[model samples]
Target chain A: MAVDGTRPYGAYPPGSETEQVGIMTSTVTILYFAALREQIGRESQVATLPAGGMTVTALLAQLGQQDPRVAGAFAAEPRLRVAINQTLGGLEQIVRPGDEVAVFPPMTGG
Target chain B: MSVPGAGVPKVGSPEMGSPELDSLGAGIHVAVQEAPFDTASEIARLSALSDRTGGVGLFFGQVRGGNGLVSLTLEHYPGMTEKILHALAHEAVQRFGLLGCTLIHRVGTLRVGEAIVFVGASAAHRGAALDATAFLIDRLKTGAPFWKKEEFADGHASWVAAREEDEHAARAWSQDTPPPA
Candidate 1:
């Protein structure tokens, strides 16, 4: 089950000074849907972020590096949208601990 | 005027409790389920919900055949999809003066020609009903958080890409679509 966390994207107050500088890390749940799921070969996974946390864009970059296929898949399309806790999110959205992040292609549902 | 099957349980009512409406809210009913739904019964239920309803317009979207298509699978963001559908339905009811609205979208593997989605809108006049129906379907295509992937008889599968045309269709409704007299 995906954990629900408070705080919307871009609303994360920079963590306490001690928590910054990679002193503390947070676990975030990342979910894949549609083609991205196929490319990632899994539905969801837990990833640890650097102490200060990272933007959705940076997380995607890090995920891409971890899996070249992910990098290729995202690099192929610029329209991929992300959601934080099921709400439409932007690349700059912050991903904090316990947040469920979903990345997928533009919606094709009717 | 009474609809043919208006006696059926109204959607979201105690007798008709469905996963569609986790919490009974007024005027809008949304379901994102994997099971096939009875379109006639759903329409009947929607029509029965409001005494002032003059017409009920419904749209059923089915999987298209061809392109060697064997089956199609739909995936959605669970919690978000329901919220998004509710938002769309609420907007339709307000903008089109609808007495009630119903939206049900099926997920999971589905065969060609199977109903993939349905939208029903009830209003005091045919104009509102008809326009709201179109608006709901158009907006649902692009606004909802669902994705489709098609599999071919030859064992090949591909994700369905969002079409520019669908966005255009949804956008058309944004400019205050006039209700036909």
Candidate 2:
């Protein structure tokens, strides 16, 4: 079960000084959906974001490099949307450790 | 409106309930069921929830008789289903200044003339509500992970293929211009 956490705007709430310099550490959850889920063969997984403030696009690039299946699904850009926590966000959205990030194809539900 | 021991959340449980109103709030209702739904009551529920809205647009999708086909079974990836619906609902809210919305889709065995899906939207005027309702339904049919298996009257069954037109319909919404009427 994905626990519902209270992170506004899918990012960490503003202002908290807990920077771990040079450690490159943060626990995060990743969610996949639709054809992306089918291609990845897994719906959800936990990962550690690269240190030095990773963006949604960079994280996706990393996933693509790690798994050819994921790379194939994201071969074309702008076909997918990233949401942090639960709200829709842009590719520039900053991802932090312990944040829940979800990547899905363009939505098609009522 | 209720199912026992299905592990599904209740209609107004806090974890899944809306804070703006007594039940699931004035806008949006989401449900997944195994049995047939009563169209009249569903419509009434949606209408009753609408407030200060000038129009209510409804889309009721039904199983069709394809000569010998008699029933259909729907399947979905559970966790993904909820996540996708929640995301879609948020988009609908943003796209249209909707007063209220409702989505009810039935899974498992369903026969012709039975309701397969329902989408309702309310807005200050007819245009937004009507367009948003259509957009939501079109997107849901193509985007969601749900799949249908049709059963013929002769006991034959097969998975329904995804239509390219449906994908096009969904993609059209991403554009700035309105779809043709």
Candidate 3:
């Protein structure tokens, strides 16, 4: 079964998440900033990934479930950008343990 | 301090004293900090490092006062910030034959009328130096991992939104394939 609030688009069945009961999960550091930080009420938090590995999109889905406000932010997908360990990253990027992931709005710097 | 060029490719001829080689020390210096910098002194230092430098082009981005913004705050990804700036400077040096380059961006809370960014490029000719300076500034505006939040005089605050015009400006460099000689 998919973790409640963690699955976006319902790509996988909810109960399927339990199939990995014997498998190991990975940890990822997720950071929020600016408006996201304000909305989420924290700068950073650690998230657990599925047994195999989670992509940035999957991570967002997981985080979106953790809080209604976070879920609302993701409603504006494609408008949000993320960074994996400080470099600009995309949804397809696989997240591994010890990786620091940052989610924020589009940059407006010169 | 030296700018770390991680993913940025090495550029400029060996004789040009690129910081990439390190033997002659780094000609490209980048800094991302909370403290303000002495713009004139910094430009002077970059100019003195490269003997072949004939023209030094400089640009300063400042927070405009009376523009409804009372204060501004900049946020960036730590390690990635310097790396990206170094990469931009590296490309400028290699693409335009720059003898040296310097980039500085300030973070934390800043008041209206304070300088926010500084970019300088030095080359044997004015064209190269000027072009490189433009390239660095334009790219930094869109490519860097920095974000800006503006606080109005009335206490209202909002994140500065990314503009399509800025993206269009950055895309020009990529679209101009083969680059003008």
lDDT of 3 at B98: 79
| Tens digit of per-residue lDDT, candidate 3, span A1-110 | 12233422212221133234314346666766667766766666667776577889888887888878788766854588888766788889998765767788877776
List where candidate 3 sits over 4 angstroms from the true fold: A1-25, A76-78, B1-25, B176-181
Candidate 2, after superposition: displacement of residue B39 in Å?
2.4
Which has the better DockQ: candidate 2, or candidate 3?
A: 3
By lDDT, the best candidate is 1
Q: What is the TM-score of each candidate against the true structure?
A: 0.79, 0.57, 0.81
User: Which structure is stronger by lDDT: 1 or 3?
Assistant: 1
Q: Tell me how each candidate scores on DockQ against the true complex.
A: 0.30, 0.10, 0.29
List candidate 1 segments past 4 Å from native: A1-25, B1-24, B175-181
User: Which numbered prediction scores highest in DockQ against the true structure?
Assistant: 1
Error of 1 at B47 (Å): 1.6
Residue-level error in angstroms, candidate 1, position B141: 0.9
Clash tally for model 2: 4
| Order by TM-score, highest first | 3, 1, 2
Rank by lDDT (best first): 1, 3, 2
Give, for candidate 1 chain B, the lowest lDDT window spanning 10 residues: B1-10
Q: In terms of TM-score, how similar is model 1 to the real structure?
A: 0.79
